[model samples]
Target: MNDQPILLILMIAVGLYTFNLWREDCKNAQAGKPSPSALPGATPASAKACIIAALGALVILIAETWGELRLGLSDQQSKITVLFGIYTLIAAFIEELIFRGFIVIENKGRALRWAGVAMASVLFAALHPFLWKWEDGVFAWTFSAKGWFSTAAVFASSLWFYTVRFASFNPHRSLLPCIVAHATKNMGVILIKGAQGFVVGLF
Candidate 1:
């Protein structure tokens, strides 16, 4: 069974859910309640936070994928890099909005907040196939070393994103920093992978 269709369907579902969250935020704003926008505008401080978060993500990615850094893409893979880049940016924004903006924001109280973060981080990690691959009929009970490492890395990254989003200076809890940081991380991965592909092609 081709997983691409399942993945595409999952992406659409996530996109719709994110859109609903944005709509709710708009409604809450109109009612004079505190709510974060899914696509909030970035302030200078948020921009700085974004840079910090992106750099942090890059460090984590580099550490996690160090051995695979030299792996290259095929000609077909190179051709799809642009499309993947766009998908990464949009997907990162939606994931951040859902996990940090909606999930974390909705759960009130310190205990609930931590619980929310933990649950969201786990869900975020699960969404990445690198961490847990689905086999012929089900997800594998056993993970490769890479899968375990990726899961840990993704969980940590999700926590980092939540921290940045929640710590925004904006009174309305803007998620711009999270979005920017996530996009930057995705772009960095794409660029690095593309460079690797070019180098391999030269040899």
Candidate 2:
């Protein structure tokens, strides 16, 4: 079975859902209670949080890239096209909305929240195809030491995303920082892949 159709449908679904959430957030802001959602909050603190989170992502990505080079690990990334790159960018936001926005347990104690973060991070890392692959509608499992290193890096980044969402720097628990951090990492991956000649054509 072709995967493009499935990916297209999934992308549309996520786009619609994210748009609805933004609409709801707009209404909430008008009502003076935005709650914890994916809205990029309007405040200096929000901007600062995004910058800090993005810098942290840069650090992690740099280290991961260096490690991959040192280990002589080939880039397992799929070929990049304009459409694929766009989808990946949107995915950065949608993933944060789901993993960092929906999976969070606000108003619960710190222990429970951290527990949820850990579980979400594991699930996040596992879904990235480092330990498994799905192609032509067939699923297969594969792993390597280098793949484990990459997966672990993903897990660590997820933890940082969660941290920026709930850290004291972001008192409103805004998802902006999480989105920024995720986008930074994804863009870094794309650039690295392009530099390494994994990118095919832009379109």
Each model's C-alpha lDDT?
0.63, 0.79
Best by TM-score: 2
Q: Each model's TM-score? A: 0.65, 0.83
Off by over 4 Å in 1: 1-45, 67-81, 105-107, 134-142, 168-171, 198-203
Residue-level lDDT tens digits of model 2 in 61-95: 99998888888775555566655666777788788
What is the C-alpha local distance difference test score of candidate 2?
A: 0.79
Instruction: Put down candidate 1 lDDT per residue, 109-203, tens digits, no spaces.
Output: 87788788888899899888764446666866555655566667788889878777666343445566677678777777677667756322211
Model 1: residue 175 alpha-carbon error in angstroms: 0.8
Per-candidate clashes come to 0, 0
